[model samples]
Target: MEQLNLLFEGFQHALTPMNLLWVLLGAILGTAVGVLPGLGSSMAVALLLPITFSLDPTAAFIMFAGVYYGGLFGDSTSGILLNTPGNSSAIASTFEGHRMARNGLAAKALATAAMGAFIGGLLATTVVVFFAPTLVKLATAFGPAEYFALAVFAFLAISSVVSESIVKGLMSLGVGLALAMVGVDGPSGTVRYTLDIPQLFDGMSIVVITVGLLALGEVLHIASRIHRDPAAERVKPNGRPRLRKHDIKKAWPAWLRGTAFGLPFGIIPAGGSEVPTFLAYGTEKRLAKRRGDIEFGQIGSIRGVAAPEAAANATAGTAMGALLALGLPTSATAAIMLAAFQQYGMQPGPLLFERSGDMVWALLASLFIGLVILLILNMQFAVLWAKLLMVPRHYLYAGITVFSVLGVYAISSSTLDLWVLLGIALIGFVMRRYDLPLAPVLIAVILGPLAETELRRALTVSEGDVTTLVSSPTTIILYGILLAALLFSGAKHLHRRARQRTGDSEGDKELIDA
Candidate 1:
């Protein structure tokens, strides 16, 4: 009941003219970024971080929340039309969404995606409003050992379980951990990897790392292939962006299923919406198959489009709750947002509600506002948004490169940062080239310090007793989950390898017969 009153007060602040305008602007820009391939909410937020330096933190975060939600809406647009998803989260949507477009159900796919996102986001935001305080209570009980255990679980989940190959993911994690080791040691106040440089004393800025890796690295990668990859042609919607009667029957149930699938993942430090979206897509497909419907591989199922999209946006919404309530960032975008919170000298967790209750509730209220605005804009102007693809590749990437450099330079007046940015961008290019997952790298960089600090603190409290690390029930449970995840991932990897080898052997025999 008290939470309801606070939420009502939040609506009062969020409904203001200036705040609403910011929400509208963020939604529009976020949609544009989402429609463009290789640009995501993380890059968008990183690039905009500099511009928000002079603005009020509440207003700035409100706009960011809008962009975060709007990005999910926009990514599905491109996926459905051009089959080029803006981020991994939208990859599932592309499978059925693009097929729907090919079948001339382009407008229907757009409508389904937008509506599904709206429903999922709205429901998840409501969850955040009521359950955030409860989550905060849970977070406050975590001690150093528990925090360390949780960090280890996050590392294993993202690096070993989520990636296509555990080796590549762990390699990416190693790079991030190595980078995290640079500069002054947190406990002893001893400089470790400064190379006798003054700028290295304070350590590498999160803004520089984020913009370099997500924005600049992506720009360079795209520029290198601009000549080889043909430009994506714009695909217009076939009709009004309204769901047909048949689509409504199929889509609403899928939306509910996807919301259920995604809500919990937001609390888990499993990286991002990709995992939940994939799960939702698979579930929908399995259900459709059980119903004797082969729309998956045949003409494209609206359920496939609906479920993954809902899952993606639902995860996006609840991810914010997890970040705020627990001071844990479950995705790359949330990691950047966590950095933003630190930039303002504000740490998220139980303390956030006690200190910034107004801001938290207002942000929640703004999400509801942003959802309505995004749905209206997407449904009415999807074709216009798709027109973004009409821009030439060289121009789009060049602008992105310019913005990345400018955003990084403006934040801190240091030539060393530019050098660091270039180096990280090169690393980012290498990671992308080798198909290494970027999320684990970002996760390691953000959580590495926290994990180390907590581990050291736990050891000191126990008088250097290593066994104390698992002395707590929470720590023990976390380690158990970590072991289970590793074993499951290993089994899955082996099965995949076996299937691939079998396929290859059959191909060889077929060739011999031929």
Candidate 2:
């Protein structure tokens, strides 16, 4: 009840005419960017970071929250209609969503995605409102060792579990950690990797790295395959999406299950929405009727789209919790938002709650409003958004690349930054080509310096006593969890490989017998 009253107060602050306008503007812009393949919320937020410098902090953050949730809503349109997932979280949605579109159920797919996201967003925001204060209090009690351990847990969980291969994931993390080392050492105040370049003194801008990898790298990757013939486009819906009674029955359970899957993972440090979505999808497949009128993939199981969409938006909301209280970013979009906060001379930690309480509450309030706005816009305009698929691939990617380069250059007016963009672009291109996950790299880049700084601080405070690193119960528990995750992941991979080999051997024996 107290939390509800505080949230109402936050609404009072967020519902001001100017703040509402910013929220609407952010939603519009976020939707536009999200509809464009390769330009996700991270890139959108990064581009808008500098522009927010002149605005009130509350208004700027409200706009950013709009962009974040708006992108999640908009990305599904592309995934369902164009078979191009605007955000990685929407990847699973593409499987059943595009299939549904091809079967002339495009409207249904879009509706479900939008509504599921709303439900997820609303629930997650509620979670944030009730839990954020308590979490902030607990986080404030954390020592440097606990914080360092938390960083390690984030790094390992995200890098190891999210990617297809652990080696590639670790390599991406290594690259990001290396990039994070470019600036002068904080404790020693000595240059580490500046190479005497003046631009290096300030370190590589988050805007540069984000735009380079996500936007430009994605553009270049698309360009490499532009010559291939496009797939037959899915038909767009001409009327409102109607859910049959049976469809509703099926979808409701999926919605509940998906929300169940999402809420826990959102609060935990698992890698964004990917794991939850996959888990939900797999669970739905297993729990589905053994003999059903509708096949799992055929006719588009509502669970397929609902689970991932819910997980995606839920993760986004909880990610905000992590960022605001713990100074951690669980996803790329969150990282960019963190950079935006820093750009505005605000550090989002315990002190932030004390100093910027109203702003924080207002941001949370805007999320609830944003979810409602998203639901209306998505349901009403899904067909129109589907029409975006008609855009020529070449033109879309070309414009993105141009904008990416322009956005980066505009930040600092440095030709050297352009060079760095190209270099990172090449690196990103290779990583994508090899099927490596980019999230780990971004996570490492953002968290590496902080991890290092905190570790050193902990050690200094303990006068080099190694036991001090785990003196606290929280630190010990966090490290234990990290260890368990590593072992579990390793065991799973080995078992999967063994199963594959066993099947291969059986096939060979059959061939020999024949």
Over 129-226, each residue of candidate 1 has an lDDT whose tens digit, in order, gives 88866644554567788878877876767677436688998998898888878888889999978899978887776656655676567666766766
TM-score winner among the candidates? 2
Stretches > 4 Å off in candidate 2: 1-26, 29-117, 124-133, 226-367, 510-514
Give candidate 2's error at residue 473 in angstroms.
Answer: 2.4
* Index of the highest-lDDT prediction: 1
Candidate 2 lDDT over 235-325, as tens digits, reads 4353456566877777777776777767655545444665566556555654553445265567677767887788778778877887887
- Candidate 2: C-alpha lDDT: 0.74
Q: What is the lDDT of residue 79 in candidate 2?
A: 63
What does each candidate score in C-alpha RMSD? Answer: 6.9, 6.6
Candidate 1 lDDT for residue 469: 90
Q: Candidate 2, after superposition: displacement of residue 427 in Å?
A: 1.7
Give Cα distance to truth, residue 428, candidate 1, Å.
Answer: 2.6
TM-score of each: 0.65, 0.68
